[model samples]
Target: MSGENETVTYRVEDHVAVITLNRPEQRNALNFDAYDRLERAFRQAVRDPDARCVIVTGADPAFCSGDDVREIMAGPKPAIPPPPTVRHAPTPAAMAALECDKPVIAAVNGAAVGWGMELALYADIRIASEKAKFAELFIKRGLTCDVGGFYRLPAIVGPAKAAELLFTGDVIDADEALRIGLVREVAPHAELMDRARALAARIACNPPLALRYMKEGLRRAAYGDPRELGGWAIETIRTLMKTEDHREGVASFLEKRAPVFTGR
Candidate 1:
């Protein structure tokens, strides 16, 4: 099975669903519509009985560069007090991947920064290309990270290392990531997808029900409730979005200048 939308492409091969972020021109940075499409793609994979495992990757030259800052940050902002809502969750795409029953592998072919790193964190396993790079850049943007950064990073690479990455917003290469135990394997750039597919095939051969239960069991036993964490992250981000420092962060990036934060 194969299908595609404007920003994402979906296909299933040998009981493994492959979802690729297709906005390579923007380094697959997601805008609002892209986020919606990505969420739907994950849900589609979940509903497809043929899909026993899922691989999430991005177009060549980059994995995901995080949010489309120009569209998301430079555009006219929404009111600070958003309209009342019944529920709070991470971005739809992040939440969908977090809840996906099938095992997910992130094949990081290039840069995965900011929300892109969060996307990688949502995966059960990660395989990186030699060209891959990662960073938790929310601090540089004067905002807190999403649920993945807060919930999964520490668990994957220990609390102290997680704090170092998050606080500094430093970009780390594939070798460093592997050394920190952030990725299971690093393949040659040209062989990244093939390596990821091979791993997916191994996982897909397992009993689907058992796989699902094992994933759920792992989450329950290891990570605490994502809902509670998500609520805190979202609320904190909302507040930060309204801060002068965040405005400056976006402006400085756009202007290619160092930000002058007032600690406002």
Candidate 2:
């Protein structure tokens, strides 16, 4: 099932819905259209009776580099102001992968930065290539973490490590990610997808109903109540979006220079 846009592609093989991020030229950095398409693809996979598991990967050389800086910052500003409802409600795309009842496995082939790393965190299991790199780069954009990163990262890698990553926005190699339990296994670049599919197939073999129930149970155990934290995160992100530091961050990024944050 291909997406409305070619930016994302979804196909089923051996009961696994393999969703590929297709924009390798931008390192699969998602623009608004790609984000919407990705969310739809995940929702489709969840609803597809034939797909018992879902595997997300990118077209070689990169998994996802997070948002397209140019698209977000360099694009022309809107002439009309956004309505109040738009400002208050967070986008559902950020949590679409997590909302899926079937298991999600991220095959991190290469760089997974910012929301890219956050996307992997949403997965029930993650498998990375030896060449894979991960980062929580929201700070670099003068933005707070979105896409459920604030809620999921701490649980997967522990609070201290998660804080360090989020605060510094440092990139970590696959070995470091594996050591910290961010990924279950790391394979050679060529075998990354193969390993992911093997695991997906194993899970797909299980009874679909049982898998769904197990996923729900685990979700409840890990996240007792997501509402309060999720609300705070969305509001904080909205506040940060209007800051001068964020504009500077985006400008510096496009100009290939360092950002001078004023803490505004």
Candidate 3:
């Protein structure tokens, strides 16, 4: 970690990896450094065998404030993105986390806007604090949200609601987040992380391979045509059935005792 050490930090406990956005003073606003750190951290988490699940949250009050406009203005600003023929589109870190074998839970502690809200949308589950506020505020800034926001939101909340949120850029609090099916639960600010951690721990206690299969199965099923995707799913299910964890899961169910999976 360089001077960007304050950008993002990764920590692991009880088989749960937590990635925290650390620039609370800036409302954890992201720039190049934060994006780079996030991409790197997600890649590392994907490869870490010790990680059974992940929880993403902020280090301080706000979960994130989206992009840092001041930094963008000071830097070389492209008036508008040039033709797609020239540059490749950037990949979102949240997508990387979502596609990983381990499940992710987002602990939304405070304000989550634009890219920040997109990041939370990537998680398998979201738990927001009572003070948490969410908005897809790209319209307010005269920008458009990236892939995670555009694709995941509609899928999560259906077309009409997603359109309402994105098109208007209205701020929504935790209760609305739950009503719209955006958050799993809303807790007091102090208990948000603990609730997230407890959920992660429960998921971690399960057979890791089963969890992986479950996650992968659902992901592929989303927007996947059964005609073509069914083949891959068949192979995937066949492979999962042969794993030691699969056998352990069956035996554990019969024995009425928890399974001790070794991630095999």
**TM-score per candidate, in order?**
0.96, 0.93, 0.78
Tens digits of per-residue lDDT for model 3 on 1-264? 323466988888889999899898888888877877887777777888898999889867899888665564224652222324422232435435555678989999999997899888878899999999999876554345655565578888888999999888899999999998999899999999889999999999999889999988887776332222323333343455456675565456446787677667
Global lDDT for candidate 3? 0.75
Whole-model Cα lDDT per candidate? 0.90, 0.85, 0.75
| TM-score, prediction 2 | 0.93
Among the numbered candidates, top lDDT falls to 1
lDDT of 1 by residue, 98-150 (tens): 99999999999999999999999999999999999999999988999989999
* Model 3: residues with Cα > 4 Å off, grouped in runs: 1-4, 77-94, 223-264
lDDT of 2 by residue, 1-264 (tens): 475349999999899999899898899998877887888999999889999999999987799999887875557642112334444333455557878899999999999997789888878999999999999998988888874677788999999999999999999999999999999998999999889999999999999999999999999999654556666667777677789998898899888998999999
RMSD in order of candidates: 1.9, 2.5, 17.8
Quick one: RMSD of model 1?
1.9
Backbone Cα, N, C clashes tallied per candidate: 0, 0, 0
